[model samples]
Target: MWKALRITTLLFVLLGVALSAWRNERNATDWIGPLVVAVYPINADGSELAERYLQALAVERFEPVSAFIAAQGMRWQLPRTVPVDFRLAPRVNALPPPLPRDGNVLSVINWSLRLRWWAWRHDTYAGHWKQVRLFLLYHDPARSPQLAHSTGLQKGLLGVVNLFASPDMNAQNNVVLAHELLHTVGATDKYDPSSGQPLHPDGYAEPAREPRYPQRYAEIMAGRVPVGPDEAEQAASLQQTVIGAKTAREIGWLR
Candidate 1:
C-alpha cells in the first residue's frame, strides 16, 4: 500500500507540474501588463563577503534590468514598454539542493518538485505580487568562487542565480539575471552548453554583421559576445547585451 501511495503521489506531482508549465506558458505569452518580478537574496555562505553583498543590496541595483527590457521593447516597436517591476525580498537562510545534472525524465520531475515546493513555501512573502519571481543565491567567491552557477526554468516563473557576492560582480550578475528572466517567460538558451559558446544566427545579436567573427554585442539569451568562431566573453553589463529577434519572439515581445 505504501508503494502504491508513493507512486500515486509522484504521478500527481508530475501532473501538477505539467499543468503549471502549460498555464504559465500561456500566461507569459499573452501577458499584457507590467510583470512584477520579485528578487529574493540567499546568502549561500554565511561569510563576511555575503554580509557585504547584503549590505550593498538596494532596489536601484535592479534598475538597469528594467531599463534594459524597456529599451528592448522600444527596439521591437512594441506598443508599450515591457514593464518589469523588481523588488527585493528579505534574505532566506537556505536554498533547496541543486537540480540533478542528469537529463532524464525522472530527474526533471524531481527538480520540478523541488522548485515548486521552494516557490510555494516562499510565495507568502510575495504578498499578491502575481507575476514572475526570481531568487538570487549569492555566494562568497573567496570561500568557493569556483562553485557558482545560475539557472532558470522555462515557463516556471522562478529562477535561481548563483554568483559571487560583490559590487564588482554586479554587472555580470545582472546579465545572468536578465538571461534567466527571459527563460521564465519562455526564452530558450541559445548557447552550446558543452562549450559555453553562443550558437549561430539564433544566438548572435547581429547575425548579419559584415564580419561575424567579432560581434559587437551579446544576445541577452546567448549571454556572451562571440569574439571568434570558438571564443566568447561575458557582456560587461546589460548595455553590452540585447534581446535578439529570436529571443524577442520566444518571450512574446513579437509575434
Candidate 2:
C-alpha cells in the first residue's frame, strides 16, 4: 500500500506541474494582458569585463525588446497595447545547470527538469507566478566572441539566453533575446539549422516582394534576412525584424 501511495503521489505532482505550465502558456499568448518576463543576468565567464558590464546594466537596455513586442502587438491589433514586459532581476551568482552536449532525448528531458527546479529556487522576482523566466549569460566579446545557441522551453515557460556584454551589442543582444523569448510562448524557428539560413516563404518578412532574393527585413523567428538565394545575414536589431504571419499564428497573435 505504501509503494502504491508513493507512486500516486508522484503522479499527482507531475500532473500539477503540467497543468500549471499549460495555464502559463495560455495566459502569455492570449493577447489579453501584458506578459511579464523576468530576465536574470549572469557572468558567463568569470571575467572582469563581464562583471563590469553587469554592474552598469540597467532595465533601460531592455526597453527595445518591450517596445518591439508592443509595436508588433499594435500591428496585429492585440487586445492590449503591450504584449510583453521584460523586467530585469537581481544578478544570479550561481550558474544554471549545464546543458547536455549529446542529443539523447532522455538527457534533454532530465536537464529540463533540473533547470525548472533550479529556476524555482532562484526566482528573485516577487510576482503572481505568471512571469516567464529568462536566464541571460553574458560573455565578454573579447573573451568569447561566439556564444552557444540559446534554448527556450515552452513546457516550463523559461529560457536560457547567451549574449555578449558590451554597450554596442545591446541592440544585437536584444534581438537574440527576443527570439528566444518568443520560443517560450510556442514560436518555432523558421530557419534551417544546418545552413543557418532563413527558409522560404515562412521565414521571409516580405515574401511577396517583386524580387525575393534581396529581402529587406528578417522574420523574427528566422533570424536572418535573405540577401541572396544562398546567403543570409543576421538582423542588427529588432527594427530590421518583423513578426511574420506564421509566427504570429504560432504565438496566438493571429487566429
Candidate 3:
C-alpha cells in the first residue's frame, strides 16, 4: 500500500511539472506580436482581380504548411477577424509605421513594396517580420512596372507572390511570395542562379523550370503559394522555422 501511494505521489509531481511548463510556454507565446496586413489600391480591373486572388488563397489548401508547423510544435495564426484592408492613395506617403516593437506589418501588392522602401530608406526595417514584411500580388512579371527595381532597403533577393499572373506566371508568383517571406525570416533558397549561384538563395526560377526544383515545387516557400495538400507539410515546416526564428529574435532567443 505504501509503495503504491509513493508511486502515485511521484506521478502527481511529474504531472504538475508538465502542466507548469505548458502554462509558461503558453504565456511566452501570448507575448509575441500580432501580424498586421495592409493592401494598396488596385485599378478597378486589378482590384477585382486582386479580390479573386485573395479568395483563391483563402480557399486553397494550407494543410502542407500547417502540418509542417505542427510537426515542429510551433504556434501561429493568420488574422481571422479582419479581411485585410486596402488603403486609398494620394495624400499620405507610401510608408508603414515603425515596427510595433512586438508586431509586424505585411503589405500586399505594390503598397507593400512601397512601404518596404520607406522603411528601408529610413533604416527602420530590421528584416521582414522582425522589422516588416511585404507581400505583393500582380498579374504580369515582365510588363509590371510596379515591381520596379528594389532600393537598398529590400534585397529583392526573394519575391513574394499573388494569384493574378497568367496561369504559368501565377505558379511562379506563388512560389516567389512564399520564398521571399521566408527570406525575411531567414530561409535561403536552394535553387541555382545563372551567375554561378548554386542555389538562387531567393529560389525563383523561370516559369519553364518550375518542375526541376522539386523542393520549391513541393515545398511551401516555392510552389505552395496557395497552400495545397501535398504542400501542407512543407508549409508547416516553413512556419516552424520562420516563427521560431522570429520569436527567438524578438525575445532575444539568439542572444
Top TM-score hit: 2
Q: List the residue pairs that clash in candidate 1.
A: none
Per-residue CA lDDT of model 2 for 26-132, tens digit only, reads: 88888677888899999999899899999999888889999998888888787787788778889888889989999699999999999999998988776554568
Q: Report the lDDT tens digits of candidate 1 across residue range 70-112.
A: 8888999867685687878877777866877877999978887
* TM-score, predicted candidate 1 vs. hidden true structure: 0.87
The C-alpha lDDT values of all candidates are 0.83, 0.90, 0.35
lDDT of 3: 0.35
lDDT of 3 at 64: 38
| Residue-by-residue lDDT tens digits, candidate 3, 159-211 | 23333444444433433444444444434444222332222223222223544
Please rank every candidate by TM-score, starting with the best: 2, 1, 3
Worst 10 residues of 3 by lDDT: 83-92
Worst 10 residues of 2 by lDDT: 123-132
Q: Judging by lDDT against the true structure, name the best candidate.
A: 2
Error (Å) of candidate 2 at residue 14 is 3.2
Off by over 4 Å in 3: 1-131, 140-174, 195-255
Score residue 171 of candidate 2 by CA lDDT.
Answer: 89
- Summed backbone clashes in each candidate are 0, 0, 17
